[model samples]
Target: MPAKRRPRRPADDSLAANLRFFAILMIAAILLRSLVAAPFSIPSESMLPRLLVGDYLFVAKWPYGWSRHSFPFSLAPIDGRIGGAVPARGDVIVFKTPGDNRTDYIKRLIGLPGDQVQIRGGRLILNGEPVPKLRVADFLDPVSPNSPCRPVPGLRIRLARAADGGAVCRYPRYRETLPGGRSYDVLDIGTTPADDTPVFVVPEDHYFLMGDNRDRSADSRFPAEPGGGIGYVPAENLVGRAMVTFFSTDGSAGWLMPWTWPGATRWNRIGEGF
Candidate 1:
């Protein structure tokens, strides 16, 4: 009897097997970054003190559920894939800008759907009630060549004892009490153009946002006028909630010189949960 020939696997079968393995890995990475956590960088000081420029943060996507904004692109071409719970007040959220979906914004949720939000005499009023505010400290504007010439008012000089027992001139601190009793720090710049803005009622399905920096940030208080900020943002624009800071650097420092790395890196902010 002739020897039986051994069976052979087709080349197409080998190629298909490899492709399937690659596809699985890609899908797993996407799901992990989209549903669990992702990294975000702070490009501006809108949420200063709490978040600083150059601070790299980790945003949690599952806390409030996933929206169309949660996908790789702001718009969900395939619907019903991801959905999230309604965002709550006092939560620090990251979202796409209303008009331009390409831009991302991070702000504390001051108003929710159907809530009336307004800033009167520099105090936040929600649902026709004044949110309690207590002065904290003065905020000093860092010297920069391109910085504005405007000076912040109501800034009281205070002595802040440093770690080495040296005192520095610092502004007072303030606490903002939300309706649900959530309070956070706010810089007391006294009064600015943003303090006397008109009252705005948050439309249904939309939200009101304000920057922690108050006077310096261009947020929902003053849309993009000559020198204004973004106005109220819709719920659909929310991307995720800021969870914690993973890395940070002082804006004044640069990474050009290797010798400057030690001083430039904000080691204390590392591993600090926001």
Candidate 2:
């Protein structure tokens, strides 16, 4: 005799099956975002000349290993960190501020654990040797709604006209080479109190970070306080290393105007890698 066919599932059972499928998809997405890479948007010019406000980039999470901070809300069950590795000097990284331990701050890693870092006369001194700084052409930052070209506090504002007659902000930019020969641009607007500071020995399990925009950044040179400087961030607070810029805008696009979106996109900045 032929076997009997099974009864068809009810409509409610079918709906529950669909919901379960979606739940699995949500869990997969969360794991991917936490373990692989995640998108981050630049909100400040602290990393200017490389990263600009309105630029959206991918931050690779696996580079520095996995910690509670690597996951959303720092709720991951991991203790300390797993498979952690020391980041190279000059690697731009995103981490939680040691102050609040919740706010995200992105900066370049400068001093490793036990390394001494200081600023003298607007120059970076690492391990008692001055890092090479060469004068470069002024960075012509385009004036946009995102970048208003407003002068940094206590500095003079300089503006220029682009080839198309658009307003641009002229900044005194320089190229700084770290100890390991990693080179990047920096903006030194003028003399500031941070121009000179006592050497700070990076504590074990901590890293010293600074912004590429030297004069305007409140980094390890200042005390850890809410809404301000981030002092020697703990390694466990590391989130990820900036990988590449995927999207960018000039902050001129209105949600109501779909036609303006394409025009506002920063085409040249897309696909740029660190």
Candidate 3:
């Protein structure tokens, strides 16, 4: 006769199957966020015109290769970036704020390694040549809890709705042309302290970032200390290059309310490319 077989426990087999499914799902998530793309949300007007405060977009991790910063919470134990790639002049990027590894900052890559950068009279000067800033149509921002277009430095305005239940805010806008024929929109609030800055030569393996909102942005132009301004960002700190906008909201919706999605979502901005 054949040898007797022990009975299998159905509950134990089911528990093992559940654990395996969760493990595989977690691995897939980490791989996608690390090697393919990851989602990020805009929290400020630093990247205005193209990116808004309530916009949610994807950052492509493959463009700049693998680095510790590519991982969520930067949990990797590597020394530096592997298969690293430098972001282009006009490419928008997300990186760990210099000196404060915990913070993530997004901005346009202006000064590349060894490039001389400065702001003179509300215009960007690269390598002693002034980058052209031409006046453009006013940039209109709809009045909402999310689109106040508020500038930095403790300035606040009471937002109000229009008579038609819709309103908009306006600001002076301009087109800034960087070297290599790249151009983007910028907003300027006349003159500010950053309008004139001393020439800063970008060091090797480093980059200088700036915001499209000009004077309102606290980028490499300020000290990265208690003032909380971002300074020169390192290559190893790079997270990824911004690719496209996935979703956006008007800041009037809450998580528990599903009905608000139709009105609160900015459908036009969805699938917008960076």
Candidate 4:
């Protein structure tokens, strides 16, 4: 006698089970993105010579711990932040604007809690000492839809031709060495009102930030206003620390042109670590 076989699951029930499995998977993915790491895109030139427009990078969420700001739409239920850690100066961070608590801004952390920060004569002064600013080679940014050579008041937008015949925008770049020897390049486009500012004492649990593009950025130098400068950001507002550049484009790619995608990618900028 042949052994009896078990009845197969109903087709409707099987389909429902599969749907449930997929739903779980999607939720897991969303949780990972909200708590582990998430991708962020650079949409401005405030961090130029390092981060450029169209650059997509992953931000590690665990570095500064989790807060309501860490979750999408600031929906986390926990009060303040848990498992918090101190962020190092010179770490590029993403945070919610103090002005709105919704707008996200990325800038290099300059002044930590209880630190003094000021800008004078286009030089960064931290803790009453000047951060070394050494003149460096010009940053030859390729001109594209993403990076246009815009004219600044009282200054010319220097133009250059790349060896590959691409139009290039030349900006004076400098290397700044902060305390503890951490260093990075910055662009200084002549003088601006923000070049001089009174010393700012960072309050407890707050951090001061500034952009690499000294003259063009509306950072801590200005008063916090909606759709404008971000004042000192509270510790609870920190989102993540930038980890690596995953992808970049020159804004020349068109959705309708498949072949243009490859050529429009800024291959050299990808995989860059912060």
Candidate 5:
């Protein structure tokens, strides 16, 4: 005898369909984040001026080629195989902190592999040639407006008119030209601790990095002292290059509840290319 016809359950079918859709969505997101660009928020002012504290920037994973550091969670077991082209000097890159590989750091690459780098008399010298540095303005900490931190005693502050017709205060913008004619901005907090120091020759397969906010950044200059920076970083620790700022918000502005998102968002910085 034929058994009773089984009934198709709508609820079971719907659940299975929903699970498949969610799974697909999650996989797509993972793939996009892993292969394409991903957004990273600046947690510290170490990269200041170039990348503010609340700025969210996009890091291009393919520019320097993929390394274990390029993968999501930085879980590639193999070490240093994917660097196709060596990172150029003056490129702003994100890398793993040398002292602790677990921590990620972002800084401008000053010394390339096999390059001589030193700080003498508040100037950067690459391979015995002094990189030109011109003081442009003074930098003030917007987060702490009334803080005592100001431009160095000798240096002067320069206020530039923004495109929006508003005045923005900044510490002198110095044109620091590298040995290869790569020039970028540098900030001098007038005779800070890092201004005068000994010379360091960058070893092979390693690089010297520093923050745009020279006086405030703990970079290759300091070496794990009570309040120092981690030394030179190896090529294996490099993650990617920071390309542009995708989002930014004023750190002082935040919502107490869910209703304040519209007000808290920094509209000006949205879609603003770096």
Candidate 6:
């Protein structure tokens, strides 16, 4: 004969309910961040004139498909990208730093595997051809925390008054057109050491990346350091493609100053495409 089932206890029922709810929430969050989309915050001015410090953007996970790097803790057990799609020449992307394969980095995709890339006189050289760069109006920069555009090493900056009477800093900005008509703005702080580099032949399963803020960035031009400089990023290290900026702040407001928060928000940069 079948034994009578044990009666469900109230305490046991409550504990099980709570555990189930927590599990559901964890599962949902995991799925959303992994399969759907993920939020990334810009911590530096590396991609300046395109992505600024304090910018919050969304990274679309589906563009390059899934690799082991796609999963948090990188536990996918996969070798290369699955359902992978080769990114275009000018797409802005966030990927794992080459040395660690753990640190997150955002930069423009400048070279593909086997592509010859270099910088000469601050101009990007792709496949032995110089990418066209057109000078644009000076980019007006306001005083923001950790803004790389200002306190420039060797240039005189003309100051301007903003509507709020805050001192405005100015930096030279230019438009760079890559091959196939893709173009974006970049900030140049005269010629720096990074402006000229030995020709880097992108290796198989690797990519060459550089920041729009050419003078300030230490990208593929620098050899990979354990926790610092990024070298040749592996194609499998790609996390996602930057799609849009959902929020931005200039660090003008303090946590205690709730009323000033809205004013500190960069409303104009919201919904900006990358």
lDDT of each: 0.73, 0.91, 0.85, 0.91, 0.73, 0.86
lDDT of 5 by residue, 90-153 (tens): 8988887877676778899998877788888788888888888876654443433212233345
Residue-level lDDT tens digits of model 1 in 193-248: 78876778888877888888786678888773333466778666777888888887
Model 4 ranges with Cα > 4 A deviation: 1-9
What is candidate 5's TM-score against the reference?
A: 0.81
Residue lDDT tens for model 3, 1-274: 9998888899989999999999999999999989899999999888877788999999999888888888878898877778856689999999898867868889999999999999888789999999998999877778778986455453322244555776776667899888789989988866788989999999998899998988668899987753367778888988999999999998988879999878889999999997
How high is each candidate's TM-score?
Answer: 0.78, 0.95, 0.91, 0.94, 0.81, 0.92
Model 4 Cα lDDT, one tens digit per residue, 92-154: 998998999998889999999999999999999999999999998899999999999987667
- Show where candidate 5 strays beyond 4 Å: 1-8, 137-170, 224-228, 256-268, 271-274
Candidate achieving higher lDDT, 1 or 4: 4
- Model 2 misplaced stretches (Cα beyond 4 Å): 1-9, 152-156
**Residue-level lDDT tens digits of model 6 in 1-274:** 9999999999999999999999999989987887668999998878877877888999999999988888887888898999958998888999999878888999999999999998898889999999999999987777766453356557535567777897777778989998899999988877678888899999998988888888878789899977667888888899999999999999888989899889889899999986
Q: Give the CA lDDT, 0 to 100, for residue 34 in model 5.
A: 57
**How much lDDT does candidate 6 score?**
0.86
- Whichever of 3 and 4 has more TM-score, that candidate is 4
Q: In model 3, which range of ten residues has the least summed lDDT?
A: 151-160
Sequence-dependent TM-score of model 1: 0.78
Cα shift from native, residue 58, model 3 (Å) = 0.3
